[model samples]
Target: MALRANRVRLGIFFVLIMGIFITGIFWVAGGFSSPVTTSYACYFGWSVGGLNVGSTVEYNGVPVGSVSAIEIAPDGRLVKVVLNLEDDKFRVDDTIVASLFFTGITGLQDINLESLPDSVERLWSEDQLTFESDMPVVPVRSGTVQSVASGLNAVFQSMAQVDMKELNDQTIRALTRMNDLLDSVENDSVAVRLSRTIDNFDAVLVTYNDLGNELTAAIRDAREDAEPIVEDLKEFTGELDNLSEQLNMMGADLHNTFNVTNSILQEIRELLPNVNRLLDGFSGGYRGEEIWQ
Candidate 1:
């Protein structure tokens, strides 16, 4: 009986050791954990497709955790996805918006947590999720679907804003007016009038051109005719200047002759006085002049 008890005791110890070994293996493989994890609920306003259990949860594209559970609301209007973030130190505030994003073409959905570019939302580290309150929820965003919808919405809005009937009426009126104008231009009398006006314009242009040419030719001819006159005038002026020089020389010679004549007369008068004394003895100065005459 003592031997049987020892065997049972050894078997129990071996079983306990194996159990511990298995638990350690599962722990290392992430089957269980002692670390605290954060949980948040994502209430998708839109459809959640391609998402299943164990979908990846990423913050700014970095893998941080995964979707832990999924359930529909009581009203069947929303799908709440519970996310388990492992060791996330940061608190999710209004600045962080959670959205559904694509991992690849595989159609696998991922939770994308990101900060809004406009920064309208505040970033708070102290904001904690209250257990009694409604789970802090982020609305899922359909990236491609939302973009396509927005673009289509804008296009539809613009198309709706246009008054198609009014636009068509204005266009028709404009076309009718243009047709009337075209019909008026197509009239035979109008065509003839237009042709006459064009001919008159052409004739005026030709006349102006001919007048310009004739004026240029006349000016050339006048310049040619004035050339000989200008040369003759230059020659006449030269001759006049020469004649003035000759007259000035003649006047100078006359002046010198007059001066010499005056001096000779004075000498003669003096001599006459002396001669009269002698002419009183030999026919006085006036008597000599009368004889000379």
Candidate 2:
């Protein structure tokens, strides 16, 4: 009875220990507790090489959940991942977004939730998004490989639209025109014509300088000659003024002489009548009254 009791107690102890161990294992495997969780789906058009189930999902670097499932959609065109967040109280409108991020040197990829600007706030659906939501799936971006491929595709597309042949022809024409200009500059006749033009310009300058000096000398000589001429003219004007005063005095003298001559002529006319009467009186006294009459 004592041995059986001891054996039963040991069995119970073993069973209890195993149960605790199993419960711990299930908890670590995300199966032990049923917490209120919200599930979200994100799809990557690029390959999800380093991503898998149970990978972590972080919101701005704070761990919120782990991946619940990873599968291709019905279209088989993208790798769709379902993330079950332990915390469901936070808001994740269009102001939030998800992307694929790598962790450590092993190249393991996870989903990263980040904030977006308010530009597209209204674009977010009023309803909260869930793994079962049937609306249009918002696009998610992947790092290195997708970006590099997209960049190359853009570059090739841009290159495809370029007109290489036309560009080459234009370059050749420009080179030809440049060569012709250089050749013309190097020609002997062009060089001779340039030198002659320079010589003509120099001669013209020398002629202008000589003509300026001659004009200056002529102006100085003309000024010197005009000074004596101006003085002579001044003296001649003074002499003419004196001669005019003398002519005025001579004209007054001639007027007085003409008045005296007219008085003498009047006196002679009166004396001649008186002398004729005197001669008649002498003849009357010498001969008689009849001879005097």
Candidate 3:
């Protein structure tokens, strides 16, 4: 009976140990003591490549939550992802945005939460309105990979629209025309004509230089010949100035002589009047003496 009791005790102990081990597993799996999480919806206009449920959600490179669900909106134009983030880990407002980025070189993608400046306006989409969840929507922006992929897509589309055959035909025609022009030039001896033209131009330049030198020499000789004539003209001007001074002195002497002659004529006229009076007195005395006799 003691052996049976010992066996039963051992079984109970084993059951308790198993129960504890299961509880530990459940706890580790987050079946118990689940953290308080806040739900948010993210809308991406681009392909969500490599993103799946349970993908890590990060805020500025720190893991803060996980992707709970991914689905296409009813409009079928945008992808909607549900993110479960730890409560109070960060704030979500109009300034908060979500983006998809590769986790590493593995090509696996995850959602990254980032803050925009307060001055940035919130972007809204028609697809976002279709979401029935009351969770605050976090607008999605293109990451580096998405932007690069978009650029490559545009390039491919542009290439697809190009008329390559026509372009090649035009290029061939241009090359043919160029070759024909070269052949014509070669056949016409254009190089020889060009060389002759250049030689003629050089000859003309040399002639022009010789003419210029002759003109310069003639000008110098004319200037030298004119120097003696300019000196003669200067001497003539000086002689004219001396003649003018001498003429002025002669005119002054003539004026003085005319004044002296006028004074002598006045004295002579006075003496003649006195002499006429003396003669009249003598004639009266001679007549009175004749009467006395």
Candidate 1: clashing pairs of residues:
279-282, 279-283
> Comparing candidate 2 with candidate 3, which one achieves the higher TM-score?
3
Residue 273 of model 3, lDDT score? 54
lDDT of the candidates, in the order given: 0.60, 0.60, 0.67
TM-scores for all predictions: 0.47, 0.45, 0.47
What CA RMSD would candidate 3 show?
46.4
In model 3, the runs with Cα more than 4 Å from the true position are: 17-31, 118-134, 153-293
For model 3, what is the alpha-carbon lDDT of residue 194?
Answer: 47
User: After superposing candidate 1, which stretches have Cα over 4 Å from the reference?
Assistant: 1-36, 88-91, 117-134, 139-142, 150-170, 187-293
CA RMSD of all predictions: 45.4, 49.5, 46.4
Best by lDDT: 3
Off by over 4 Å in 2: 1-35, 88-90, 118-139, 142-144, 179-293
lDDT of 1 by residue, 1-293 (tens): 99999999999999999999999999889788564678877765455788888998888888778898888754465567888877754466666667777778998888888767543332112242222325556533445654455555545555565555765665565556545554544344444544555565565566556555655655567766866555555655665565566556556555654654565455445444433433333221211112112
Question: Can you give the lDDT of residue 130 in candidate 2?
Answer: 28
lDDT for 276 in candidate 2 is 55
lDDT assessment of candidate 1: 0.60
Q: Quick one: how many clashes does candidate 2 have?
A: 1
For residues 1-293, what per-residue lDDT tens digits would candidate 2 score against the true structure?
Answer: 99999999999999999999999999898895677877776765566788889998888788888888888765565567787876564445656667778888898988887776755222113242324444334345435555555555545555555555764565565556546554544344444544655565565566556555655665567766766555555655655565565556545545644554455455556445544543443332111111112
